[model samples]
Target chain A: MSAVAQAPGPARFCLVLLRRQLTLAVRRPIEIGNPLLFFAMVVALFPLGLGPAPDQLAGFAPGILWIIALLSNLLTSDTVFRSDFEDGSLEQLLLAPQPLFLSVLAYIGAHWLLTGLLLALVSPVFALMLNLSAPAVGVLVASLLLGTAVLSLVGGIGAALTVGLKRGGMLISLLILPFYMPVLIFGSAAVRNAVLGIPATPYLAIIAAMLCLAIALAPLAIAAGLRISVDA
Target chain B: MWSFFHKLGSPPWLYRIAGTILRWLLPVTIVALCVGVTWGLLYTAPDFRQGNSYRIIYIHVPAAAVALAGYYVMAIAGAVSLIWKMKMADVAMKSCAPIGAALTFIALVTGSIWGKPTWGTWWVWDARITSMLILLFLYLGVVALYEAYDNKEAAGKACAVLTLVGMVNIPIIYKSVDWWYSLHQPASIKMTGDTTIDPSMLYPLLLMIASFYALFTCCLLMNMRAEILEREARTGWVKKLALGYRS
Candidate 1:
C-alpha cells in the first residue's frame, strides 16, 4: 500500500518490517532479554513453590506455563509502543511515505520478532525445568508462537488506545485479560492434552483458528485506536 | 417529530420528562413488579420436577432478559456516538455500562442459586451461564477502559470502539447455549406456548419482564439527565434551569 512503487508485494512489507524489528533487537539485546528472563523466572518459580517432585510439577505444568506466558506477554505490552510514542518516532513512523497502518503493523511485527519467536525458542529450556513432557513442550512452544503473536496484535491495540495515559499498564491488563481467556483456555488445554498423550491436534487447530482471527481483526482495531488517540 | 427529537436531546427537556414520568412510573413499576412477582410465585403451580425451587425463574429470567437487552441499548448508543457524533449518545452509552453490569451480575448470581436447587452443584460451565458471565466481563471491560484514560472524550471514543468490538460476545453468549446444546443442557423454561409450562407461572414472569423494562427506562433516563446536566451546567439554558430550582 505504500506509494514508493519499489515493489507492491506482501513479502517485501513483511520481511522489511520483520527485519527492522529484529535488527533493532540485535542492537539492544537487553530489550529482548528482559522479558524472556522474566518469563523463565516466572516458570521456574512455580516448581519451587510446588516442591521438587517431578510428578507434582508436571501435573501443574500447563497452568504454570500459560500464566507465565500471560504475565510476560503483558509485561512486554507496556514497552511495545511507548518509546516511539514519547520520542516522536511514532509520528515519523506514521508519516512515513508508506501507509500508516503498515508502519503500525511493522512496529508490532517487529515486536513479535523479539517476543513471540524468541519466547517460543526459549520455552523448551524452562519447559524442562517445569518437568513438562516432550509432547506438552511442543504444544507449549507452538501455542506461544501463535498465541503471543495474537497477544502482540491485541496488546498493540491496548497500547495505542492507552498510550497517552499515565500508568496504563494495570488498565491494559484489566482490559485485555478477559479477552485473553480463550487463549489461556485453549493454550493450557492443548498442553494438558499433549501431556495426556491425547491427539491434541484439535486443540492446536482451534488455537490456529483463533490466531488467524486475531491476525485478521486486531490490526484494524489497533489502527482505529490509534486514530482515536490522534483525535484527542 | 424533529422538534420532539431535538427537545429530547436537551437536558432541561429530558429532566422535565423524566421527572414527570418518575412521579407516576416509579409507583407503577413497583406495583407491577409486586403483582408480577406475587402472582408468579403464589398463583402458579410448582414444577413437577424442579418444584418450588423452579420459582427462581421469576428473578433469573427477567434479569437475564434485561441484561441481554441492556447490552443492545449500550451498543446502539455507542454506534450512534461513533457515527452521529452526538454527546448525548456518549452519555447514554456510558450510563448503560454500569446498569447493564449490575443486571448481568444479578443474572449470574441467580443462575448459580438456581443451579444449587436443580443441578446439585453451585456451578457448571453451561452455555447460557457462561455467555452471561462473558457479557458481564465485557460490560466491566468497557467501563474500566473508559475510566482509564486521562482525556475524557478520548476515553469515550476508546470505550465506544471497545464496545463495538466486544459486541461479538453478545451473540456468542446467546447462541453458545444453543450451539453447544448437546454439551450444554437445554433451557428448562421455554417462553413459547408449549406443553410443559403452566399458564399461572407465565403471566407473572411476563409482568416482571415488563417491570424490568420500565425500571431500565427509568434508570436510563435518570442517568442520561444527570450526564446532560453535568456537561451542560456551564451553558446559559442550564444556568437558567439550575437557578430556577425552587427548593
Candidate 2:
C-alpha cells in the first residue's frame, strides 16, 4: 500500500512531536498518576479478596500483577485522543508543519512515558507488599517496563483508530486485546516461570521482540488511522 | 487516476457488482458446506483413540482455520479500503468482521466442548485456546470500533488500522500450539508431515476445510452486499439498481 510511500521525513517529524508530547506529559503529573493508582489499587485488591498467605500470595503475584498492568494500560488507552480530539487541539497539531506520523508517534511515546514507565516504577512497593521475591519483583518490573511500552504503542493504535468514535473504550479493548495476547502470555509467563525458579529468558525475549515489532509497525498504522478518522 | 477514484467512490456500481457475486456464492456455499459436513460427520469414522469426539474436528478445525484466514482477509481489506479509498473494500471489511467473530466464537465453543470429553476439563490455558480467545477479542474490537462512530469513513479507518496492527499476532496464534503447554493436538492439515491419524479422518477434515472456505466466501459476499447496500442506498446508482435498470 502507498500508505508508507507518502511518508515525509519520518525521523525528524517523530522527534519534533516526540519532544512536544514528552513536554506535555511532564506538565501533567496527575495524568500519569491515574494508571499508577489503578495498578496499585488492583494489586492491593488481591490480598483483601484472598487473605494473604505468603506462599499463596506469591504464587498468584505474577498473574495479578500482569492483569493489573493490562487493565491500567487499557484504562489509559482511551485517552489517546479524547482530550486533544475534543478540544480541537489535535486539529491544531495536525495543522502544524510537523509530519503526521511523527505527531502520531509523539502521542504514543508520551502515552508510554505517562502510563508505561510510571506503572513500572510504581510496581516495587506493590511487589513488596504482595510478598513477591526480589527476583520476582525484578522480573515483574522489567517486563512491565518493556511490555507496557509495547502496550502503549499498540494500545495507542486502538485509541487513535477509535479517536473519532463515541463509544471508543470498548472498541479499543476489542482491537487491542488480540495484539496483546502474546505479550500477556509471554510476559506474565516469564514472571510466573521466574517465581517457579525456571529460566524466563525465552519469554522475556518474546516480549522484547513483540515490543520491537509493535514499535516498528503500530506508529504507521496509528498515523494512517488518525488521518482517516480525522478526515471523516 | 481520476477515473479509478471516481469508480471506487461510486457506491451504486459496487453494490451492483457485489449483488452479482452474492447470488452465485450463496448456492455454492450451501451445497459445499452440506456435502463437506455430511462427509465429515457421517462418512468419517471415529478416531481409534479420540473416538466419536474426533467428529468435532468437522466443525472445530474448519472454524479455527477459517477464523485465522478470515482475519487476514478482513484486516487486509480494511487496510486497502483505508489506504486506497475504496468504498467497496471498506464494506467488505466491515461485513466480514462479525462473521469472523462468530467463526472465532464457534472455534472456542467447539474447542471447549471437544476438550471436555477429550481432556476431562472445561478449559485450559494452553497456547492455542488462549490465542483463539484473543482472536475472538480482535474480531470483537473491529466490529465494535466499526459500529462506534456515526461516521462510516471514520469507523472504517479505525477498524482498518486496528486490523493491520493486529495482524502481527496471527503468526503467534498459528504457532501457539507448538509453543505452549496445551493439550490440543498438532495440525491435521500440515503440508509435509507423516500422517498422524489414518487417511479416513484426514480426508473428511480436508473436505470440511474446503467446504468451510466455500461457505466463508458465500457469507462474506452476502455481508459485503448488505453493507454496500446500506451505505450506498442514498446514491443515484443505488436508486437505479433498486429500480432494476441496466443502463
Candidate 3:
C-alpha cells in the first residue's frame, strides 16, 4: 500500500501542476477563450475576403482552418511561461524538488487542453461554415488534435526560450512558426486527403509520430529553457 | 589531446589561432573562387538545354551546400557551448548565423535567377529552394532570439537549445518539402541529375564547391575573430591589441 502510494508521486505532481494551470486559466476566462475567438474571427475573414463562393472556400477550407489553428496556437503559447516567469512561480518551479520535466509537460498539457483542444472542438463549426465536406471535418478535428499537441509542445520550447525577454511578443512567433510548418503541412494534407476521398491515416500517423517525438524530447528543452530563463 | 580542447576554450588562444588560419586561408579562398568562377563561366560548354543559365550552378549549388553545412557547424558549436559551457563555442555559434543567413540568401537569389532563365519564373516552390529558404529563416530566428535577450549568457544557452531543436527538424523539413514538391509538380530542375554533365563542366563545378567551402571557413573564422574581440573588449589582450593599433 505504501509502495502503491509512493508510485503515484510523479502522476500526482503532474496532476497538481495541471490542476493549478487549469485553475489559473479558468480564473482568466478571456485569456482562455482568446485563441478560439481568434480562430473564429480568422475563419470568418477568409470567406469575407475570398468571397462567398462555396466551392472555392471549401477547397481552401482545410488549409485555412489549419493555418488559423497554427496562428492561434502560436499566439497563445507566448503566454504559457510569461505569467509564471513574471510572477516568480517559474523560479519556484525551477528550485522545486520534483523533476522540472513532468511539471513542464503538465504546463504544456494544460495549454493544449485550454487552447488547442478547444480550437479543435470548435473547428468543425467553422469547417461547416467554410463548406468543408462532412467526411473531411473528422480528419480536420483529428489532425488538429494531434497537430496542436505537437504545436503546444514545440511552442512551449519557444515560449520558454523567449520568456525572459521583455519584447518576446513577436519573437516567439518568428522562432516557432517555422517549426509549425510541418504540422501545418501534414495536418492540412490529412484533411485534403479525406476531402479527396483518400486515406488520411498516414498523415495522422505522421502527426502522431511527431507528437510522440515532441512528448519525449520537448520537455527537456522546456526544462532547459526554463532554467536558462530563471537564471537570467 | 584533452589539453587542446581546453586550449580551444581559451579566448585569446582561439583569437590568435583563428588569425593564423585566416592568414593562409583567405588568399587561397579568394584565388580559388576567382579561378573557379572564371573556369566555370568561360571554360565549360553551354548546356544544349539551359545555355548560359546553367553556368549559375557553380554559384548556386556551392552556396546551397555551404549554407546547409553551416547550420550543422553552428549547431555543433551550440551543442559544445551547452554541454561544456565553453564561451568560445558560444562566440562561434553566434558568428555562424549571419554568415549562414547570407550564404542561404545567395543560394536563393542565384537560384531565383537560374529559375527565371530555366523555368521562366523567379520562383516555383521547388523542394530544395523552399528548404533553403526555411534554413535562412531558422538562422535569422536564432540571431533574433540572441539579440532579444538582455543577458548574453542566458541568450547563449537559449540559442543553443533552439539550434539543437532546429538541427533535429532540418532532415524532417527537407524530406517533407521534398515530398510536398514532388506531389505538386514533376521534377522541374533536372539540369543536374537527369543527365550527367561531361567532365569538362563537372571539374569547375567541383572546384567551385571546394572553394565555396574554403570561403565559408574563412568567413566563419573572420566573424569569430571579430565577435571575440568585441565580446572581450575590456579584457587585457584586447586592450593591448587596441593600444597597439592606436600606437
Q: Model 1, range B1-247, lDDT digits (tens) per residue?
A: 9788777566666777778888898889989988888888888888887789989889988988998899888888888888877667788898899898999999999989988877788987876777788788888988888887767778788888777767743553354334444322456633232556667777788889989989887888788778777878798777887788542
Quality of candidate 1 docking, DockQ: 0.38
Clashing pairs in 1: none
**DockQ for all candidate structures vs. native:** 0.38, 0.58, 0.80
Local error of candidate 1 at residue B236 (angstroms): 1.3
Select the stronger candidate by TM-score from 2 and 3.
Answer: 3
TM-score, B chain alone, candidates in order:
0.87, 0.85, 0.96
User: Model 2, A11: alpha-carbon shift in Å?
Assistant: 7.5
Question: What is the lDDT, from 0 to 100, of the residue B243 in candidate 1?
Answer: 83
If both were scored by lDDT, which would come out higher, candidate 1 or candidate 3? 3
Cα lDDT for residue A155, candidate 2: 83
Best by TM-score: 3
Please state the error at residue B211 of candidate 2 in Å.
1.6
Clashes per candidate (backbone, < 3 Å): 0, 1, 0
Better of 1 and 2 by TM-score: 2
Ranking by lDDT: 3, 2, 1
Better of 2 and 3 by DockQ: 3
Error of 3 at B197 (Å): 2.1
Report the lDDT tens digits of candidate 3 across residue range A78-119: 999998999999998887767889989999999999998999
Scanning candidate 3 chain A in windows of ten residues, the lowest lDDT window is: A1-10
Q: Candidate 3, residues B1-32: lDDT per residue as tens digits?
A: 99999999999999999999999999999999
